[model samples]
Target: MGEEQFKGVFVEEALEHLTLLENALMELEETPDNMELVDSAFRSMHTLKGSGAMFGFDVLSHFTHDIETVYDLVRSGSMKITQELIDLTFCAKDEILCMLRNDYDTIPEVQKKKDELTKEFKDLIERYRDGGNGATAKGTLKKPDGKSIPDEIIVKDIEAPRYTYRIRYRPCTSCFLRGTNPLLNIEELAGFGRASIVAHMDDIKFLDEYDPDACYAYWDIIVTTEKEIDAIKDVFAFEDESSEVKIEVIDVSGELDGGDQYKKLGEILLEKGDLTQDDLDSVLGLHKKLGELLVEKGVVNADIIEAALAEQVHIREEKKSQQTSVEETATIRVPADRLDTLVNLVGELVTVQAHLTQMAVKRIDYELLNVAEEVERLTCELRDNTMNIRMLPIGTTFDKFKRLVRDLSKELKKEIILATEGAQTELDKTVIEKLNDPLVHIIRNSIDHGVETPEQRKKVGKPPKGTITLSAIHSGSHVLIRVKDDGKGLDVEAIKNKAIERGLISANAELSDSEIFSFIFAPGFSTAKEVTSVSGRGVGMDVVKRGIESLRGSIGIESARGVGTTITVKLPLTLAIIDGLLVRAGAGSYVLPLTSVLECIAISKDEIDQNHGRELTMVRGQIIPYISLREHFFINSTEPVNQQIIICEVNARRVGVLVDQVIGEHQTVIKNLGGIYKNVETLSGATILGDGSVALILDVNRLVNLVEGVERDAVKRLGMASEMSVCE
Candidate 1:
């Protein structure tokens, strides 16, 4: 692979390892005795370190090695996990993220922190690996049977660690000035196991042509190391600044100890990269030890032949391991922009199909109308299929919050458990991405403010270990996501007092429990007396509400003094298109989301006029507030004698929306109004109608808010008039 392509793959693979490593660590903290988690963590660290080294990220590799060493002890039952160790691991995880992002400015600070934490790991390894002096720690690193651990164990569970590499190192003419010693690197590689070298004198110039300062010497070094190719390459980290170093793994587990080997001469020659495959294939017909024959013909030097034979055995061993690895499931990673484009194209197709249907209906041709209906059917099917492709299970997004809960519980010194249900609930990928932050904020609030401390819970006769449940499930065409907490619920009177004190509501304001609970979403409204890093600063719920609402969703809260609090967010299945009820206020048609609509109630203009002050009327003995679309949009035309009120629920309260006429259901292809209608909160967006007219899509949540705003004003006016009458 090309360098850039390989780097992309490395980053993708490295991030996966990091995620698995973090999760395993979290699980390990809960069950420190679980060997499976220990092994998982060990494997992740091993892979990460090797990959980092392979990509020339020596800093990453070296730091991870210390962590790997500690986990090795943990896996072997030499070291027991402690709270101190888990804290250090969390710090290490953060440092690894900073390193992966390559934030140079932050890396220096993280590096210093890494050094401090890694030393603790090193000390633990030293104290447990032997029974000698400085044994202040309680854990033993030594094997219980008094058996010495092999050097191979320091790496991983491998049968053999003998990999031969033929190195060609030629330094820059002025490399000596860089203070990089090539011989030192060579010595380090030899320290692992075995080594041999043959200096290439062919490149050396004649004495008259050579310069004293510029070195002309280079070498072909043969070495076998008890490490991976990446580990050996790491030795040359500094050497690459001014040298050309080519190190290829010629063999992985060759039995080079025997003077007489079983490897054929042609195979060895081909592996050494000196001879091509065609040359070996030609000689394979002569099924004899070809090396002796080659020696007899004086084709290659004795030393060169010796190195190839040593490499030949290890190559075959490498092949055996390759054949044993299970095939990995392949996946393709596509850019998000491409998916967005596809969704947009499908949206256009929906619009065009609507236009075609309108054209066929206007023409009154049976065949054209039939074809149009068929086209519409196919279009709807296409839209559904395309949307399904974009739908992803919310479990992945939910899984991410485990770490958040873990670290926060630790920092706050509170015992908490996060349980999730309906994690497999699917939603549009776009909606899922937008939902993450809101979920995070809500979870943080649940952890910080909603959930009580262990001692506090016990005093209230509740379980000391608080529980926060995150759940998602489909409700018809929408999804209901609930973040429920088991702790001291919202103190209603306290919230009421806070709302009154904040001037959000009057003392005489009579509201339902849900309405009173929704006061928590007011901007900068919080009952929190103290501010911490978590959600107590009063800046969270408002943002969460706004985020969910921006996606055509609504959030509601239910709380009891001692029971608990559950914040439920209702969201559309997809943001692309929806089924809506089309209606007209004056000349303009508006579309109301079909999912929210209950039943329409027709009322005459006379009834609407008589009930002017309250903007409400009796619907089956229920006084439901209604929004007059004519007045809402400032329609200049007079209202028709017969009008309809669309009954819909928003924020847990059912309300009526007045319209001039009800024009049945519409298959809406929503389009952005962009800058033109961006400021109009009452109208969410515009959609193209069948007749090529633009229909404004009403924001039911905002429409309910408008009716509430009118009521607040009426109450203010009434209070003022009453005071004036008392003065009179």
Candidate 2:
């Protein structure tokens, strides 16, 4: 066929092979002794090399060959899989990706790196090759009986049913330059069975315009006789190393004479009864003189003509499928940019629908109002659909941690097991991508700092093997991701002393347990006695805090020394939009994430009390600290007759935010407040109200901290709070 068609096939198959390679490597790591995984890995590489050579990627094929050879040995049980071998395979996989992207200038350096890794692979293979005898040598397989064995094993003399060999050969563009003859390969196949060629002229250029150095023709040969597929494959063994070839068995026993030859476009159309001789003649006439024929003859309706054309197209596709080796399957590979574009379009549609709703409310036209209402309903559904497209199960990220924990535990000389729960919880793709690195850092820190050694754990009357648990769940409009470790928890006193020494807190400063523990996320803060490369470098925890914050999320730590530590991160379900509780704060309107707002109550003057010069309100049976927007934002107000208190929860702690009035629920479109307002503590983002006014989205976590900090300071001064006031 056309070069474009072949190129598409090559790219598709190459990507499939790459994915297979990655999956096989992952499986091989877990079950290194499973020969099936090794064999599958080898086949994927072999197919990739053959496909790459067909597509003019010579360097890729050459580099992959070496890796394939190593896997081949492993598949034959002559070599054993080891950690070093797996690492080398990962490097090889990376190189194959680079080669697929057509990067060749650095191939030499990459090959050098591969050579070094291959040397280690060779050493391991030799070690295993010497069997359990503990001798190291090359090019020999020694059994446990201490006897040298042959390099390769052969199985022969098996009988099976008679089969026909159908070989298809599509040479590479540079085949002629390599002094290869496709005709000679076809002739060599005669040794296996009776062979006849069906020359394909679909890819041939014009005789006068053809490039002499490029092979442009393909051949489909049918050999009807009793012979194994491998026997036929061996005939063209030399050419098969560099050519694109497919061999399959055809059962001619149930077909009519000349069936294969009749599988052409026009013949298939006739056989399928989609077109008659007269219809074909009429269409051909119209195609040749299109402008006149349409008006001159009333042969058929335009719809009928279109339908006939569609049928002809389908027929051609069916014929092409039968003639080619490619399988017929329904699948689509879309570029990532297209999905992003679709999401953006859906977002814009939602915004426009909001504007339309505004206009429809002002007009008195019933029909226009009805249309806008329907549009709003559709827009909501569309938004949800688009969001769902970007949602992926969190299990994909969790499965990778097993390998991480396995490798790290071995390195640390500790026994640790990672248990994941609710891994099927779904989150936006963007959130998952950003969460990977932070989660890895947290997991590493748990292994290095949180989990104690086996000896220490045994002394503490705990299990020798520490367990780190990762769980995710949906909470209202957010997803809660928790990393819990069964190890030594945070030491509040040590953290307090470090904060004082680092000038983070005053020496005489008094703080609660949670407040003291928060110091771990502060910049340049660490409590480790000695720094290891895995952790205690004082770099990642703060970064994790910043990353969670960047996603409009909050993180908190809960700990009990010698019990355990749990770090929970709360993130918005989707970043593009949110449901908010809009309220009037000072002269401006602010939106509080509806997910965090529990209830609102109007408080009379009698309920307002000044305790140690701090505003406090009794909600239900609990005394909750309150922060007034007027005082917090420097908004001067003369009277406070009937004040409203908005009770909100932050990480399971309740607090009240005093506002002028509660304005009802709003469907908010989150807009970034630029770099200047990024550091604003109490505001997460901004949105436009139905009245066309800009409203600030309140950060519940930050507000909780502010109000709680104020109340704690007041209680510390008065010395009247409970001993459990240390909120851990």
Candidate 3:
């Protein structure tokens, strides 16, 4: 890869490391004694430091190194993982991300942050160092079993023993073409410790035949360093598969075979498998240099003799096993746009398949019909698989809320805990991404308004800490996400009075608790007694409503006095396609998402007339309100004698939709109605039919809301003279 591409890879990998650090830190704060989390954070930070420096992010690397020192101390039990340390590390992690985004301290704001964070980290290190006589100066050194260790028994910040290793590095001939500079690796090796490096020129070709792009020279080096064997391997990590790098321990703590004696040339060669016993015997008797004699006898090549002379260590077998495991679990990252393009193509194929099926059915060709059936089945399978690719577990987004809750609770001086369930419920990537803001609004409102302060909660016979439970679950083809809080619930009388004062509801208008709670989402509506930084501007719930509606989802609220509030948002699994019940109203066709449809019952103009023009109908002896599509959309046509009322559920309530005929279910690939129809809230999107007709997909929740809105407006206009009870 080119330098720019390599940098891109570095940025992606660095982001992964940052995520690891953030998640580990968050968990470490909860479980301070979890050594595994500490180790994980340490490894991620160390890798970030090393990789940043290698990728030319010097400032980032330096910043990471400072923070990594604290983790190192914690790892060695020299310092305790305190809340203050966790908070500081969180800030440092954010600074690291900012530095990375701004190109390693190029931006003034990020540079300033880096300076502040670096000073804090340094101060922390220094304070810990001076707090006690030794390791205990910073904090108590606790063992894994939670017992404090005495200072004398603890060894902290001690230098590791150094080992001397012989290294033979022969770069592949095409390494330079693959964008590797062998010199960089060689230079890195030099930094490990005191070293002797010798370049072999025996393989160099004649000047006329030499290729500048091909690597011919190899190196033999002996180095002693305090770093582990893995550190050496990391220097050549990128080239491990392509280059021949042999590293063998020659001495440990200045001991070679525990004495001054060293291995003979024949012994080194034989251990390296460069010379057989017979070949070794032949060379030993010759009294010539073992390597030269071996080459002269044609028993080994000159390069092999040279390599054996170096006799470096091979990577341990366990390391190879680890690499194998890593390779098995490796994944390829594909750009999201490509997946979107694939889904779009699949949608087009579905439309064409529907067209083909319609044509075959009309032609009365059994053979062609069978073929079309097969095509339809394949299309459905392909569509499902394509959608599944975009499905992501909701847990990724849930993790982010933990930090949100933690910081906000601190800022508000409240004791609150966020509990989540069904985080593994999967939704489309697009839906999940768009859902962040709406969920944030819901959660923030829950924390600020729905949840009570510690004292208030304690007075109410509750625990000092309040809880907000965010949960999601699959409801057929849709997912229901609910945010529930346990604290002071909605004050029904106050909400009703406010709705009246704001002209949102007639004073005498009797409405259900759900309806009153929904008034909180109105523009410029707030129940807060005073404004604060977190909320009370009257903007959050309004945006929440609009955002959820924009995603073709529905939002509802349920609350009881002093029992807390719950906000539920129901959303489709995907935006690209839906299973819809196709129906006709007057001359236009419409689709109701099949997941919402409960059943269909026949109704007629006579039945409506007999009921005195009322919109209410009886279903299984229970009264249900219904909307006539012809009257609602003003579609002018002669009414059918036998009309169908499709019973559908919206916001946990059943309503009937009156249409002329109920067509069978359709695999609908929804198409946007564009900006022109953006203001039309009832129709979510349009879809193509088998015979090339366009059927508008109805937003059932919005339709119900629209009807309720009309009824409220009517009551307001008539001074509450005549009441219409179509919705409850």
TM-score of each: 0.71, 0.63, 0.71
lDDT of 3: 0.83
Give the alpha carbon lDDT tens digit for every residue of 474-590 in model 2. 987789999999999988888999988876666789888887878888778998888887877688898887788767788889999999899998988887777888888667898
Task: Give the runs in model 1 whose Cα sits over 4 Å from its true position.
Answer: 1-9, 105-107, 131-330, 717-728
CA lDDT of every candidate: 0.80, 0.73, 0.83
Worst 10 residues of 1 by lDDT: 132-141
Residues 1-728 of candidate 1 have per-residue lDDT tens digits of 69876767788888888888878878887898888788788788888888899987788888888888777777666677777777788788778777777574455677688788778878877877653422223322345565555434544655555677877777776766667676787678778666766554555678899876666667667776668888877888776556878887755564444233435666556655656676545555565566655555555555556656555554454444444552443457866778888888888888888888889888898899999989989998988998898899998888889999998997898999889999999999999999999999999998998888889999989989999999999999999999999878888888899999977788888988887888998889999888898866789898998899988999989887788899999999998889999999999999999999999989997887786566888988889878888887789997789999999988777888989999999888778889966888887888887677899999899878766777778877898899999999
Q: Lowest-lDDT window of 10 residues in candidate 2?
A: 150-159
* RMSD each, Å: 19.9, 17.5, 17.2
Can you list the residue pairs that collide in candidate 1? 128-141, 129-141, 252-314, 253-314, 254-313, 254-314
Model 2 TM-score? 0.63
Error of 2 at 690 (Å): 3.4
State the number of backbone clashes in model 1: 6
Alpha-carbon deviation at 138 in model 2, angstroms: 15
